[model samples]
Target: MSKIKITQVRSTIKRSKRQKATITALGLGKINRSKEVTATPQILGMVEKVKHLVRVEEL
Candidate 1:
C-alpha cells in the first residue's frame, strides 16, 4: 500500500456533521494537524468528502 499525508487546512465551523466526522475519522480534528495513512479506496473516499478542508500529499 502507498502512504499519503492528510493535513487539515481549514476550520470545521459551520460545516456539516458528516464532514466533521470524516475529518475526525482521518485523524484530523484541528486545523494544521496531519496524519499519514495508507491510500486505500475507503480513505480516498473520505478525503474526497472533505477535500476543501484538507491538503493531501503523496508519500
Candidate 2:
C-alpha cells in the first residue's frame, strides 16, 4: 500500500472530543507533528473526520 504523511496543522483546543481523538488515533497531538501511515480505508476515514485539523500528503 502507498504511504501518506499526516501532519497536525492546527490546535485541538476547543475542538470536539471526537476530532481530538481522531487526531490522536492518527499519531498526532501537537502542531507540526507528523506520522507516515499506510493509505488504508480506515485511516482515510479518520483523516476525513479530522480533515480540518491536519494536512495530508501522498508519500
Candidate 3:
C-alpha cells in the first residue's frame, strides 16, 4: 500500500470529543506532529473526519 503523511496543523482545544479522539487515533496530539501511515480506507475515513485539523501529504 502507498504511504501518506498526516500532520496535526491546529489545536484541539474546544473541539468536539470525536475530533480529538480521531486525531489521537491518527497518532497525533500536538501541533506539527506527523505520522506516516498506509493509505487504507479506514485511515482515510479518519483523516476525512479531521481534515480541517490536519494536513495530509502523499509519500
Error of 3 at 51 (Å): 0.3
lDDT of 1 by residue, 6-50 (tens): 999999999999999999899999999999999999999999999
Worst 10 residues of 2 by lDDT: 18-27
TM-score of 2: 0.97
lDDT of candidate 3 at residue 20, scale 0 to 100 = 95
lDDT of each: 0.97, 0.95, 0.98
Q: Per the 3 Å backbone cut-off, how many clashing residue pairs does candidate 3 have? A: 0
In model 2, the runs with Cα more than 4 Å from the true position are none
TM-score of each: 0.98, 0.97, 0.98
User: What lDDT tens digits, residue by residue, belong to model 3 across residues 33-52?
Assistant: 99999999999999999999
Give residue 31's lDDT in candidate 1 (0 to 100): 94
